[model samples]
Target: MRVSREQVTANREQIVVNAAEQFRRRGFGDVTIADVMKAAGLTHGGFYGYFDSKQALEAAVCERGLAESVAAVDAVRDGEGGEGTAAEAPLRRFVDDYVSARHRDAPEEGCTVAALACDAGRSGPELQQLFVSGITGMAGSLAGLRGQGSAEPAEDGGPDFATLSTMVGAVILSRAVAAADPELSERILAAARERASAPVE
Candidate 1:
């Protein structure tokens, strides 16, 4: 039977969403189109109707994943109330949550920015662009947290690139290391959080 346009659109979106989750959980190279179709509850034969190839799907998934990651950060920021601006609150929460063992064990719901970066580096140019954009967006979110209490000019400065890089790196490393030694993970996570939450001066 022929599917309605709306149904096709919905199915395509569902496929992308499912693919994003799977990709985040199992890396891009590790997941096949058949796996994605299975996760989306669609037949493998129907994959072509929605995407030209796995690369196309990867691009779409990257966009969806990045969007979800941004939303998660926004939710944490929103939960903080107006006591602080969107930029700082979210980054603080992100730093805390990202480095935790909870995030390490639950790859399906973890930060897409960190989960997909390594895989994206080996993907096609289009996929790399998506990854780059996602990283830029994440950095912008973190930079928003700076100077909330200080009288310093907002435009004059923000979280340095090195600082943000260290934060993200620390989370990824802590999670990886935590798998082998729980205490080491906790120590690294604590140090990373302290650095992220430290004063601008």
Candidate 2:
């Protein structure tokens, strides 16, 4: 029985979703096509029919995961009517939620940017472009909420780099120290929260 085109599309989508979760949990270098296929409940042989290579699947994952991450952040911002005080602003609230232990403890369900940053730096050109474009999308979404809506960020995505850097860096460090020094992890998160929560002059 041949599968319909719609089924194939659905299967590919499922594989990308499963791959995204597994990649976040296990990192990009560790996950295999078989792992993603198994997670998707599909046979391993069917992997190639869906993706040319692991890198291809990674490109799909990057697109889906980064868009989802951006949507999550935008939801946090848009949910508050986009009209809050500095302390209650979208950027501040996003930082509070993003830097919290809840996000730090749950890599599989957390930010794709932090989850994939380690691998993107050394990826091939195609994957690198995907990361570059996707990151800019995420950063642009955050920058729009950074209280500089009227001002356009640089063409190279320099605006709000500190905000994204602090969020991603703090989460990375907190996760790194979480197993060895949990208290220090909390402090790291707190510091980021405080920094982002500071009032704009």
Kindly list the per-residue Cα lDDT of model 2 for residues 1-201, writing each as its tens digit: 899999999998899889989998888889988888998999999999998889888888887888887787677667643233555666666777788898899999888888888888878888788777777776777776665433334345554666677889999999999999999999999999887555443
TM-score of each: 0.83, 0.87
Global lDDT of model 1: 0.71
Per-residue lDDT of 185 in model 1: 76
On lDDT, the leading prediction is: 2
Q: Residue 140, candidate 2: how far off, in angstroms?
A: 2.4
Q: Model 2: which ten-residue window has the lowest total lDDT?
A: 148-157
Query: Against the correct fold, how does model 2 do in TM-score?
Result: 0.87
lDDT of 1 at 42: 98
The best candidate in terms of TM-score:
2
Q: How well is each residue in 23-119 modelled by candidate 1, as lDDT tens digits?
A: 8888988999999999899999999999999988988878888877656655554565323345454455556676566776677777777787788
**Candidate 1 residue spans exceeding 4 A from truth:** 74-91, 149-160
